[model samples]
Target: MKTPKNQFWNAKYSTLVFSLAGFGFACNLAKMLLLPENTNALVFSLEALAMLFFLALLFVAINCQKQHEKWIKEGKEKSAKNIKTLMDENEDLKKRIAEYELKENEEKRFASYQEKMLRKIFSDGKSATDKEHFLHLLAESFAAGAAVLYKESEPSGQFIVEEVYALPEDFIPQPFVLGEGFHGQAAQDLSPIVVSSIDADMIPVASGLGNTSTGWLYCLPVVKEGRCVYLIEMVTFKEVEIDKMWNEISTRLVDMKIF
Candidate 1:
């Protein structure tokens, strides 16, 4: 766990030790040279001992230098690995942040689209056909293929289709009474329902009229003055949480004076 800086310092210490040992050996040889001819056998023995000691010190110093070099190389390797790990982590963080930002932008754009649709629907003197166009635009924005607007007829007590868009040209609008079908139940309760599987509780209707009934369906009630004034139906190939999206749409509708 020693850092590169510490390794450098250690290497310097080893070099210093080696250099000092060599200097001491040179000083000892100079002292031996300054001795007179009368220097005794003991002096010669002492000289030999000094030479042996210097050699031993030199060996130790060389070993220390090699060990220091090894440690320095290992430190460099570890430092490189640490730097690489940090770089990789930083890149991953950047990618995740970018993804989150993109998702946030998409949500904002979808909200703006919903607001525009609501404004078009509730504009003064807007016709049923105009509202149908707005609904279709809304569905298209959400990537849905078909959309329908249904309202309850008070005289007949039946849910009559008020506007339909993205349907086949030959398809005809149909009516259903409360408690009779899924759409009727959704309207009567003023609640939203999402059907992931069509075979669960749905009654099969005519299919050749561009009503595939092969994918997910969403029914959302549009309540006005404590009564359901309209029902929004959407069909899609993938399961979608239309209720959650509807909550955001409703908030935008209120803000835009569409409800």
Candidate 2:
């Protein structure tokens, strides 16, 4: 596109060309009326000057027309380029949105699978073996490296990790108190919690003892009779959209009577 500055320059050129043409015509008319016919030299000189002025005016008009055409062509090219760029950007955004939708569908499928497994666990009279199977299924479905079940220790007023899966053979699960650690806090609040970074604030620095290799944490409370009975802990290497996923999972858990 021709910018505002270029348009202003073009207008100025047009005005100057017209003004010169008018001045040349006026001078020619005056010379024909006032100058004496006997003065041949002056008349010829004046006529030559008028001819030169007219020629210059014609040349300038042609040049200005060419410049205007060039600017118009450039403006069209720029508009085409801008349209192509916007179309490319729109396509890229559509592709990204499709990929995200596919990922979201996969997550929902995983959540559904977890719900089925939990239903089976609870349907089997809440057996110890069933709970173990449920924990294992959750670990696999959520792609977590480890999953643990924790129960509150009333005597010590702490929450103890009762069952853990995919843990190192020698690693021991520790006890933590309410508001003391991430897991405990989740259990205390009866709300799901996610820690994206271990080094971040609000997460206990010393709480990640055995799982130093993992960077993210997910904690969910297993509520029973409107109270937190157990806590599900998951450790992952990458962060998950915990709030969004948990909201969906919580709804499924309630529907499946696992909450």
Candidate 3:
């Protein structure tokens, strides 16, 4: 048990055993030579006793060395296991940090894109024609390819599609009544509507020379002068974000002075 504790103690114990064995062997040799005139049996017995003590000390020295080596090997094994555990935990922490940074960067990028569109809408001429061009610009930026601009018709108070971009060859011009359809419902509620799956028959998009489904539709009502006066409908080939996209667009159009 003492040998299994500290290496310093084990080394000291072995050294002490070797020193005692040397001193005992020297004393027995001196007694046998200097006292040669004594009894032969007594001298022989003293020599035998010294030899046994030296042998026992040698055994203790070797045992201590073996126990120390075993303890050292066990310590190394334990240290290796602990080091491996720390390395695994460090790698997991690094992965989590990287994932968080990626998500934050994505949110910032989307916000920047939305802000750029807001500035583009306000940098054009104040005339009604300029507003239609702004709508066309929005369609191009969002990859929608189809955009319709509606103004509240005077006296009739109907939300009609006054201007359009990328209309199909077979498309017909229609005005939306209150709560009539998706666009109408958004106008009635003064809210935004998003349709992820598009049916070309029901919701048509004019791309190039033909009518088709773009798989995504968004309609927003622009409120001005305390009434829902305008509506913008967009059809896109790809899925669009709901909150991030529509929220910014509606917020910008709410204060826009171009009626």
lDDT of each: 0.70, 0.71, 0.71
lDDT digits (tens) for residues 1-259 of candidate 2: 3466876787788789778877877787776678776877866777878778887878888787888779897988898999999999999999999999999998888687656654654455444346677677667755788878887678644677777889888878787777767777777777888877765345354453344434777888766556666777888767655444564555555556553
Which of candidates 1 and 3 reaches a greater lDDT?
3
TM-score of each: 0.51, 0.52, 0.52
What ranges in model 2 sit over 4 Å off? Answer: 1-46, 126-148, 153-157, 160-174, 193-218, 224-227, 233-259
- Poorest 10 consecutive residues of model 3 by lDDT? 205-214
Residue 215 Cα positional deviation in candidate 2, in Å, after optimal superposition: 9.9
**Which candidate has the top score in TM-score?**
3
Comparing 2 with 3 on TM-score, the higher-scoring candidate is: 3
RMSD of each: 7.9, 8.4, 8.5
State which candidate has the highest lDDT. Answer: 3
Error of 2 at 192 (Å): 3.9
Compared to the true structure, candidate 3 yields what TM-score?
A: 0.52
lDDT of 2: 0.71
Better of 2 and 3 by lDDT: 3
Clash count for each candidate, listed in order shown: 0, 0, 0
